[model samples]
Target chain A: MDYVLTTNALCKNYRHFKALNGFSMHVPKGAIYGFVGKNGAGKTTLIRLICGLQEPTAGDYTLYGINNTDKKIKDSRRRIGAVVETPSIYLNMTAEENLKEQYRILGLPSFADIPELLKLVGLEDTGRKKAKNFSLGMRQRLGIAIALCGDPDFLVLDEPINGLDPQGIIEVRELILKLNRQKQITVLISSHILDELSRLATHYGFIDKGRLVKEISARDLENACRKCIRLEVSDMKVFTRVMDSLRLEYHVLSDTQADIFTKETITRLVLSLAKEGCEVLSLTERDESLESYYVSLIGGTEHE
Target chain B: MNKLLSANFTRLKKDVFLKLCIIFMFAIGALLPVLDYHVMITYEFPRYIDESFFSYTSFMVILFSAFCSLFIGTEYSDGTIRNKLIVGHKRMDIYLSNLTACIIAGVIMCIAYLIPYLLTGIPLLGFFIVDNISTIWIFLGCNLVLLIALAAIFTLVSMLNQNKALSAVICILGLFVLLMLGAMIEDGLNQPEYFEDYAYMDPETKELVIEPSTANPYYIRGTQRQIYEFLSDFLPGSQIIRLSAMDAPSPEILAMYSGIIAVATTSLGIFFFGKEDIK
Candidate 1:
């Protein structure tokens, strides 16, 4: 498969703190790759390095098959647009003025596209409003517009929806989806909001403690996170033995609760457990969520 | 000031402080000369530091340096350096953009100091100078030294610190250090002490040559009739052009002073500052 980004044994260290340790991932072409990690898991650091803001302490990363140290890497970067953490907009400049500045930064031929780009980000009517006075959501949209100045096909957004209200979040989400689908731009987004991430991700890369825990496509992830029977019983040991006798795959969630990963014969199974003198207090079936899948994959506590 | 400079120039245009600083320097620079004219009409003279480029330029340079450092250094401590790189600008371009602003700020301040000095100090010359051309050269020489020294020292301070308050304090201290160090270098080198002259010391292998008298190397032969002191050799801090203007500095010595302080320090600043990582 064609990949937009590939990192091998990438590492970065700040004094005694190891921000990214041997991190590696393959971001496929034309995919909305969701970079899921807890805060301070080196998400921003990796973005910074890939963006050329810093040099990696060890290993390397490649963009569009061009190695970072190669002459073509600079050319490759021109095809990328990124909003790392916060918006990079010049606060004192107006939105149009900011876009003009970005055009110069990218060495573009003209500022003629400023109107269309601003309209795309919903800022076309914001005549002469300096970015400093912009609302957070407006500023964020302007930031996205700034990133889109060079018409780059690859976009990197770090926590783009963070610190926004629900309506603002939806606005950003719809914009990103439209860009990916209509404009055909590949995107790499990092956010702690799993549900929001799941809504837009075509593929997933789970990171923890400076290492990539897993990388799964959306369809495969949906299949892996299945609808299972959640049973609250009096004795988990007896329930476990019964489940083992049934030859079913299950996991004990707590002292009195467990999950049975099967869709068939639920009534029959409960009767069987009752016959075996196991008291089933409450039995319910539900679909697994992205949060639960992430927890189970990394073996965190029962309550997220 | 053309489009080729547009790359770095846009960065400055967005920054209000830099813009305001330029206006501030111009207003003050334009006024100092006029103010000095008023002082001169009463037959009064300012102190060497106030009147000399070293004192006046040093003061303004320290101020300009603080402004530049805060404007540039805040980005580093705040992690905004990453955003600039992500926008596709190389480290070198970012460095150059900032350094241009610093040098430009220095030039503005230099212009500020010169206007008033020429408008006022020129008339009070009272026959000390033989011609207008010589007086202009003297002003040019002093102005070059002032801009060069201040730009170098301020660039160094900006690179070292990121906090606005701390950087300002450090820049202020840097000026003091520059003056003190220049004094130390002058004092230690000009004292003509001989190693073999001490009775307790053994003979020396190197030739033991001594000058006859103790005055600055610049003070060659002095007479009461002269308007200012005459020197045999150039002293680094000694004024190349005095207000009295009776004795004009030779072209060779003027070039040497301008080259040593202005050219040397400015280039060194550009070299180091060009390579500095904004973060």
Candidate 2:
């Protein structure tokens, strides 16, 4: 019932371009909200607006029950830390120094927590190596460490795993989970990489062209994206005839295609189709992923 | 153990621009007197000596005013500002911190910037060398503060724009306009019409004469009398802070009160700048 973030008809325009067009979303407290969208779908724009980098042209948003326009919004913002698009770290500074600079900027009393925060991000051993010399994963962790300087309860990360190698990706992924699990930090992560998002998200909101198509919990999404057997046949009428005769649970997709939800062996189904005088063209199995589910919601042809 | 890292050596902990400005200030500061000597020995040009500051405060002020905007503007242009703001900081804090850094960097400029120039005047200037060293020092100190104040004000302005080059252009143009406006206002106030003299003085006698007539008995010269009167109530530093880079105060020992006023005024600007949002 407690929502950490809520937006109502939030809109933003850059010249004639609509960066956020009536975007509305709710992030429940303590939930890892995965903001699923393609590139240029207003994820970063919305993050920027929420972070106060830019103001919304119309509508309202609330953080921790405090409205964006309230005087206490500053105090509310203190609870949220974001890495917008890329980690903003001073490449010339060491990870420790970067954390200290951030702490000073946030007006925290002292640097007592610097080492521990760096340790939390797994950048503790990076003693005097400047951030510029850091590996991509190290830089990202340092950036996250900088975000953690104020002890924020909510973390907003934009493409946090972008451009990382496999090992680096795994490191960052683990770090996010650790922070969220141990510290109880609610995370709002925006990423185009849905497979990875599916690995970490507790909840999801799919956006296309600045409008949220669906907002669903992971458990519900799993049920909606259930696995099924896809079939390509010589004739759909015959395919449906055999399926209807068998009383199987299925869907007729096209003249040449159909999908069955029932667990039937391929050889048995092949013989069954043959008896109905329908030849099997091709058969494939599909365990629906977030990407396909998104495609199902807002259909689009393959991009890559 | 954290204290093992020396705070002085903790210079590593500051912004690159702030560090570069300080380093540039001292380097220039150390080289100034020697450069002045080079100019004097080779070119036989007269050198001006001001001891109130480290050395070359004017040159430092000019450099700070021209370059500080670029440093602030670069962050906005590269979208680095978004990284800072997203970390739970209000936009106002971003502006204020950068502004404070700029002005404090200005003070550093005051110390190291003038000492070298002051040393160049080692022996003394000849008769032709207009020797108002004390007043010039006072003026330089205040002028440097004013320059930093201007830099602080421009930091907020520069961040208003997204393009670094355009922001730099607008800031320079804006500073020039303010400087000109301050000058024009002061000049207009100083230039009084004699014929339109105040009530206490007789109009016929005190009126500035445009023509040789019995009606207009007095002819105004330039702006000295009015300037002299304004000079009594106002410090040369206050006038300099106003913008047009007013004429230096009458020859006298530069006092701490004027320096305090200059620091106070410049500090106010930095304070306002610190609290403004970047975008």
Candidate 3:
């Protein structure tokens, strides 16, 4: 795969605490790479290192094949636009004014793209509204607009959908999808919102304790997630005894609920439960979602 | 660097706080001479335009303190500094561009005061009455350099600190402390070496009694006096006071001190700012 970003054992230390410890990952070109980690899991730290907001204590990363230590790395960075932690924008300026300031910073020849950029972020109709007065969603969109100013092919966003209403979340989600699909801009999104991430990410990197637990494509992850039949029974002991006697692959989720990973006939299982005097309250086939996959992969508190 | 500077200047044009400072300086500039002219008429004494000419130095110091802190602090508070960094601008360039913008603002504030002061004062009072034309030139040169030094100091404070409110408080409070220190040093330096001996009629004895002169304990002399003199020229607050009174013993030395301060603070600021981690 052609990679736009690749890291080799990157590390960041804040005084005595290590935020990122020998963490590494690869983001393929034109792929929406979901950076998944619980809070304090070094997701933001990695983004900061890549965005040049903070320097790593050890190792290095390459942007567009340019090593970070190389003098020409800055030129490679010019192809990236990032909103690390929060949207970096001038709140006192209007949305249009903010873009113009960014344009000036990027040294674009003119302000011609300002309107098109605003419209792309759904902020064009906000004629004279200063960013300070913008809603959380509007501000976030404006931040994305600012990130999109120089027509960068790679975009990095840290918790882009955080603290938004449902409508706002949907808007931002649609916007991200549009950017990825239509513009083909490679996006590296660091978020703990797995369900939202699942909808957009083509590939994912699950992180825990400042290290990458796994990096898998969405297709591989989908195939890896087991299809199980969730069963709620009256007598948990009887159900376990029968499952043990049958030697079925199973996981106990609760006292009365269990997941059987094997493909068993419903009639036989029901008859066996009936003969054991255990009532089957419900049984349903379910696919393990990204949330459950993350939980199983990291195996800590849910969402940490 | 040029792109960052152009962007910074664009933001500088819309900064309301800076505009307010400029207007306030101009108003104070125009009013100072008018008030001194009133004093001249009411008290029946001559007051030269030169007396109030450099009076804007103190106000300029305060305004620059407030302006630089807010101006640079806004970048950190609003997170806009990251925009520049992520767009491939070097941290050194960002620091230098901010310093340049602040220095320009300071110079503009000086001009704002000068335009009104010159327009109002010269017609009412008169041209500079100093012994030589060079003194005025010297004062102007020293004051301009002093402004740059002050801008550098405040920019250093604001750039190193990420908190806008805290930086503003520190810069403003820091200005007052320096001003007070300068005033105290100047006061100590101004003390007479000895009290003059005097003869006075004793009310009880009705006889003239002569008293011997005594040395002033507050008088700063020797190496201590030299240190005080250097500080009075070195500190921006002291430079303002000295320039205002037109009593700079050596304007060349004052300008040199200002140059040193500008270079030192800027070097220190850029070094630390380069190491700072932006969120």
What are the chain A TM-scores for all the models, listed individually? 0.82, 0.82, 0.82
Evaluate model 3 with DockQ and give the value.
0.66
* Fraction of the true interface contacts (Cα pairs closer than 8 Å across chains) found in each model: 0.29, 0.31, 0.87
Ranking by lDDT: 3, 1, 2
> Once all C-alphas are superposed, what RMSD does model 1 give against the true structure?
10.1
Can you tell me which runs of candidate 2 are displaced by over 4 Å? A229-287, A302-304, B1-58, B77-80, B119-138, B163-279
RMSD of each: 10.1, 9.6, 6.0
- A22 in model 3: Cα distance from truth in Å? 0.6
* Local distance difference test, candidate 3: 0.91
Compose the digit string of candidate 2's lDDT tens values, residues A198-289.
Answer: 99999999887777778999988976576878889998888888888888888777888877988888888999999878899898888887
Residue-wise lDDT of candidate 3 within A1-304, one digit each (tens)? 7899999999899999999889989999999999999999999999999998889999899999999999898998899999888788899999999999999999999999898999988998999889999999999999999999888999999999999999999999999999999999999999999989999999999988789999999987875577989999999999999999888888888999998889999999989988999999999998888888898899757545
Q: Best candidate per DockQ, number?
A: 3
- The digit string of per-residue lDDT tens for model 2 on B1-279 reads 122122212333355655676678767766655666668788998664432233343345455665657666656653556655664454555555566555656666566555543454454432223355454455555555455445555665665656788877776676556545545545554553554433354487995545432333333345854564454324432344342233445422223434454456545644654443344
Better of 2 and 3 by DockQ: 3
Error of 2 at B181 (Å): 13
lDDT of model number 2? 0.69
Order the candidate numbers by DockQ, best to worst: 3, 1, 2
Clash count per candidate: 8, 12, 0
DockQ scores of the candidates = 0.21, 0.21, 0.66
